[model samples]
Target chain A: MTTDDWVAIWLTAKLATLTTVLLLGLGTPLAWWLARTDSFWSRCVGALVTMPLVLPPTVLGFYLLLLMGSQGPVGQFTTWLGLGLLPFTFTGLLIASVIYSLPFTVQPLQQAFRAIGARPLEVAATLRASPYDTFFSVVLPLARPGLITAAVMSFAHTVGEFGVVLMIGGNIPGQTRVISVLLYDRVEALEYTQAHYLAAGMLVFSFVVLLGLHLLNRERRV
Target chain B: MKNLTLLAMPLLMTLAPNVHAAEVQLAVAANFAVPMQKIVAAFEQSTGHKVLLSSGATGKFYAQISQGAPFEVLLAADDETPRRLVQDGQAVAASQFTYAQGRLALWSAKQGVVDNAGAVLKTASFKHLAIANPKVAPYGVAATEAMIAMGVYSSMLPKLVQGESIAQAYQFVSTGNAELGFVALSQVYEHGRMRSGSGWVVPAQLHTPIKQDAVLLVRGRDNPAASALLGYLKTDAARAVMASYGYVH
Candidate 1:
């Protein structure tokens, strides 16, 4: 592969890692609240959170372009704060990726949190643990698998992000050009050998990771 | 009576589609989309051929054509792609011809931002200047060439934001994501005036002429609608629409 190809791969890795971290930080509270609450508000928010799952990336990208353009309210607010436009920057792509992969992070984490049940929290409370202590000591340990799943899914989804990035990303090298976008560029530039390398590498990488996870899960279970 | 006859031509043309109506799939360059749409509508009305128009970057179309895409004809943004297609044996060499002469423009969504002389590109006032991917789109190559001709290519390199196609480059300028951009003159032109925004049409001498070409693909062989569509492109009716959108030829 070319030097640009390596740069693209590295950029994608950074984007996915950062997106996973941000998703976990943001999604944890949202998923925690959704899991514990039985209010109608929970359902509404849950549905809203999962909306990205069904939304075509192009649609999200379109709305995001409008919302983040200079004439957009979000743009106006950012410009008011001296940040300028957000659509073509890496920060813009990160925001889009976080939104695009929110559900992928939240759903798994929510399910994990729900599976932990109230029993551990109740036991910890009976033992004179504070709410924070109970969550950190009991609930977290029980939800580790789900946490891993959420992080993995978020990272993977961000790595595969194409449409929204294509719509909003300006495709600057080492800034917003991820592997998928670079792969697209290579194909369009008629460098099929480079395209083949990127495509085959991604296929192999995804398969190995999945296989590793399966064996790890089996080992833990045994 | 002459004016009335001209008006009635379109009306009579609409009635011509019922007999021997057939569909032709076309892969058109994204830059030619607006003009191609008008041409398709006219062609359908006059020739009874239903055009399934698929528009995108010419590079993508070349890849698909090589892979045996179901497109009967290709209207490329660059003459090179059509010539390459013909060389690759994906298209008939004899069927290719220049369809339009594309013009590049320095444009900005904000009024008065882009002067007639296109001096804005030399200034560092604009944070991001958008252009289509130079490696893929012909208009992008022209934009870079224009910037180079002005001795501002190196200076403007850092501030550039590359769009996937000229349409998207126009979008970046239109949406004000980038303060200014290089885009197709046709995108901003209508009835001999810019539709919106301020623009400076780059002189043809600054860059290699973007000679957009149309060619029949191997897939189009034996398809009456495909040949008819190519024939329609050279007609006065279609040429008029092309001219209205700032295409030179």
Candidate 2:
């Protein structure tokens, strides 16, 4: 691959890593609330969290573009705070990716939290374990599989993001141009050989990652 | 028997158009979308042939055409892509002709932001300046050339934000994201003047002429409707529409 290709790959990796980390921080509490609550509001919030899975990436990206633009609400507020515009910046892409990958992190974690039941928490409570202590010592250890799954899924989803990134980021090299966009540029420019190489590399990498995930699941089950 | 008939209904519905009126699949560049729609409407009215217009970046259409896309005609944003198609034996060489000359404009949603001389480009007032992807759209190439001719290329580099097509470049400016952008004249032109935003029509001498070309693909060699549509594009009615959109013939 060319230096440009390498740059795109590195940028994509950085974007994916940052998005995954941020989503983990944001999604965990949301997922925990979703699993514990039975109210209509919780259902509504859960549906909103899962909306990205069904919503076309371009549609979400379009709204993100509007929302993060100079004339939009978020933009106006940011301008008031002297942060400038968000579109076409790395920060804009990171924010978009976090939202786009939210479901991937949240859904699995919700299922894990729900499956834990009240038995472990009751046992911890009987032992005079504080809520924080129970969460750290008991809940986290039990939820390890789900946490791993959420992190991996979020990372993979962000890495493969294209439409949303394209809509908001506008393809600025080293700032917003990720691997999928780079591949698109190569195809448009008729650089078929480079496109093929990049596509094949992604194909292999995705296959290996999924295979590893499956193996890890099986190992934990055994 | 009833179930089988029900299953075949949707298949029939999909095939019904081909069995009825003649249809021509046209691939149009993003910049020509508005005028192409008007031209297609007129052609359909006059000739009774249905035109299915698919608009996108010209480079994408070229890639799709080279890969055996179903498009019978291509209205390209640049002369070179059509010529390349002809040279590659994907299109009829004889059918290729310049359809229109596109105009580039520096547009802003806010009135009076852009002067006639395009001096706003030299100032660093706007953090983002939108332009189409130079590798794909001819208007973007013209914008780049104009910038270089004005001796502001290097200075303006940091503020550049590229859209996938001229249409999207217009969107960025219209939405107030970039503050200003280089877009096709047709996007902002209505009646005899710009509709809402201020625009500076870039001088032709500053950049290469954006000569849009139309050609019949090899797949359309046997399709009469494709040729008829191409012929209709050159008529007075279509030419008038093009002219109204600031396209020169």
In candidate 2 the C-alpha lDDT for residue B158 amounts to: 86
Poorest 10 consecutive residues of model 1 chain B by lDDT? B11-20
Candidates' C-alpha lDDT:
0.92, 0.91
True contacts kept of each: 0.86, 0.78
Q: Tell me the lDDT of model 2 at A147.
A: 95
Candidate 2 accuracy as TM-score: 0.95
- In terms of docking quality, model 2 is medium
Residue B147 lDDT in candidate 1:
93
lDDT of 1 by residue, B144-229 (tens): 99999999999998889999999999998999999999999999999998888899999999999999999999999889999999
Q: Which regions in candidate 1 have their CA more than 4 angstroms from the true location? A: B1-16
User: Model 2 segments beyond 4 Å from truth?
Assistant: B1-20
* Residue A33 lDDT, candidate 2, scale 0-100: 89
